[model samples]
Target: MRLAVLKERRPAETRVAATPETVKKYKALGLAVAVEAGAGLKAGVTDAAFAEAGAEVAPDAKAALDGADIVLKVRAPLAAGEGEVDELAMLPRGALLLGQLGTEHAGAFAERGVDAGSMELLPRITRAQSMDILSSQANLAGYRAVVEAAAAFDRGFPMLMTAAGTVPAANVFVMGAGVAGLQAIATARRLGGRVSATDVRPAAKEEIKSLGAAFIGHEDEESRAAQTAGGYAKPMSAAFLAKQAEVVADAIKKFDIVVCTALVQGRKAPTLVSQPMVESMKPGSVIVDLAADAGGNCAMTKPGEMVTTPNGVRVLGYTNWPGRIPAASSALYARNLLTFLTTFWDKEAGAPKLPPEDEIVRGVMLTRGGQVVHPSLQQQAKAA
Candidate 1:
């Protein structure tokens, strides 16, 4: 089987789907790997490195994708523009495309007869843990958010007593307790910041406590059952949101740094920090919105941009913070895709054989046989 890795074309997207290490692994798996020239430049991997690892460095995307049976990418394809060609049109019909192509774009892939696997939809089961792209990417994003916030803030993360004076540690409040939020709490704590977190799911309280961060949310019978079987937070009632917002407004005023990582799957992020809450924060305070791509959990956030409010509170809404650390992000993401592909590799067929019965395969597969096959996408198609 032949596999092609295309350079990311999205603005500010520095990550690549395959790295030199992964290219070597794919070669060992009996697959010929073709990579677009400069595919890994932003991620610090050179074409020379890929060639040394036994990968063909094609001159362009078309050359890389031509005759390839499988295509690897960091993001979904982009539509044609003045100076750009339609990336989806480059793929051969019936090709297996794998990456974080979200379900909302399933119709485009289905129309092209592309078997697309969205890594974000990977099951949370233990067997598929190695293939969980969301977790791997979010872990880096959480760490980067704190690091960037610290850099943007004037004060130190750790409390310090010097000959001049005593400097207090910054207070960091995380808005969610998912993979990203947990990592944020841990990272902030390690940086010596006084960290605290809130989440609607009752189980997150223990996770917050375990990370040595204070848990600050109303938890009752209703909230306890507000987590889905897959461990994702479910939308809360209006009454619950009102109460939670009140609590957040109070907590946020005392925090020097706020990292908003809350997101509802396939929905706009619930706004947890309102304008009044932001105005209440002290001048020079910073808020990092990791959910900026999903409409943000902070009302003050401007997606893909950083803006300071008149009150002097800085709101950062960089949509792809994980891509800011491209080398590490690409390495982890490539490993995830590699693990997922090898898990379903059919030795006799010499290609990936995704059985419809496999839960992991079924969970991520978005298009098959010229149709949007995923249950959620199917429902969305029907609704449309």
Candidate 2:
């Protein structure tokens, strides 16, 4: 089987689809891997690195994607990057393409005579953990969110006593407390910031406290059982939101750095930080909204923009925080995709899996056989 990696098409998307190390893995699995020239350049992986990994290099996107059994990319195909991708108009015909599909581009590949897989459709299961792209990317995003927040803030993360006087540690408040939120807590604490975290899921309290960050809670019965079977936080009732907001509003005043990472699995992120709430924050404080790609946790945020509210607090809506660190991001993402291809392998025959449902396939199967198969995405599309 042949696999191809093309230059990422999304605007400002610097991440590559595969790393040299993973390309070697593909070779070991009896699959040939090809990359477009300079595909890994932005991620700091030189052409020589991929060449050294025993993979062929194509001079352009068309040559790379042509007749390949599988095509890998960071984002779905867009018309702007269509110069080399043939038959993209037939993407939905269920042939072979895989990527992260946003709300507007979900069924794209099927329309272009290609079968497409969206990593966002990965099912929550013990076996699929290695292939969970969201967790891997979110971990990096959570780590980067802290660095960005610190940069945007007026004060430093850690407290200090200069020769002049003592400077108190900055208070960092993290909302959501999911994988990304927990990581934010740990990273902030490591930087010596005073951190506190909150979530509707009562189960996250210990996870927060375990990292030495305070857990802000209303402690109601509903809050106690906020987790769904898949371990994601179920959206709260409007009544619950009202009460939670009051508690969170009071908690916000004391924090200098606010990082919001809450996201519903397949829906727009819930609005947690309101405009009035942002207005009450202290001047020179900063907010990093990781959920900006969906909607945003902070009301004052606009994706990809940096703006200061009337109160002088900075609200950052960074839609693609992980893209900023394309090197590590692409490496981890490539590993995730590689693992997905390993399940149907016939070790003796040395072939990549074809009949997907091979555990990893079950995890990320979106539309299969010309139908939208993932229940979550189906629900979302139906509602829309």
Candidate 3:
């Protein structure tokens, strides 16, 4: 089978789907790889490195996608991206397209009759941890989010003590103690900041404190068990939210930096930080919303833009936090694609033979055999 890794056409996307190290893995599986020239350059993998791993360098985008049995990528093809929708038009019937799907255009891709699979849909089963691209990438976003906030802040993160003066450590508050939020707590703590994190899931309190962060949220026994088996946050009751907000609002006033990372799977992000909440912060504070692409957790955030209020508080809604750390992000995501791609026994019988009952396949298979294969997407198509 031929597998092609094309250079990402999206302007801000810096991650490539295949790295030189993983190219060798594909080679061992008897897969021929045609990597677009310089596809791994931004992620620190040179073309020569890919060549060393037994991949031929394609001259341009067309050659990269042509005659390939599978395509790997970071983002889905949008109508606007060069050679994006173009790939959709040219993909051979029954060919597989796998990558992260932006929530907005997911249905459109299904409508186009492409056999696309969404990487973000990978399940949280024990066997799939190595292939959990969302968690792997979120780990980087959480760490970088704090750094971005510190850079935007006028005050320093750590406490400073010199003969001339004694400076206090900045108070950092993190909303939503999921994978991203917990990492944010660890990052802020490592930077010598006093960190406190909150989440609707009551189970996260211990995880927060284990990272040396104060946990702030309702602790009722019922609320304490709010985590879903998949390790995601369940929406809290209105009464619970009202009480939790009270506990958080006071702490929010004291923090110098606030990181908002709350998200509900497959739904718009619930608003956690209200307009008045932003106004309550001290002057010169910074807020980085990791959930900005999902309509934002902060009421004032605008996706892909930054804003400041008249009171001197800064809110950054930059959407591509993972792109900021492209080299590492690409390496992890490439391994995920490799895991999903190499999950079959070709001994029999079929060129693209797969174990149909595989957890990863069932989780992400959006379309196959030219029919809408994902139940959620199929339901949406009916509603449309």
Global lDDT of each candidate: 0.92, 0.82, 0.82
Task: Say which candidate scores most in lDDT.
Answer: 1
Q: Rank by lDDT, highest first.
A: 1, 3, 2
**Any residue pairs clashing in model 3, and if so which?**
none
Candidate 2 or 1, higher lDDT: 1
lDDT of 2 by residue, 193-289 (tens): 9999998887788889999998886778888788888899888889999998999999898889999999988789999999988988899999999
lDDT tens digits, residue span 1-384, model 1: 799999998889999999888898899889999999999999999999999999999999899989989999989987557238688888989999999988778988999889999999988899999989999999999999999999999899999999999999999999999999999999999999999999999789999999999999877777988899988989899999988888888778999999999998878999999999999999999999999999999998999999999999999999998998999999999999999999999888889999988999889999998988998877766898
Candidate 3 deviant stretches above 4 angstroms? 79-85, 102-113, 345-352, 381-384
What lDDT score goes with residue 277 in model 3? 83
lDDT of 1: 0.92
For model 2, where is the 10-residue window of minimal lDDT?
86-95
Per the 3 Å backbone cut-off, how many clashing residue pairs does candidate 2 have?
Answer: 18
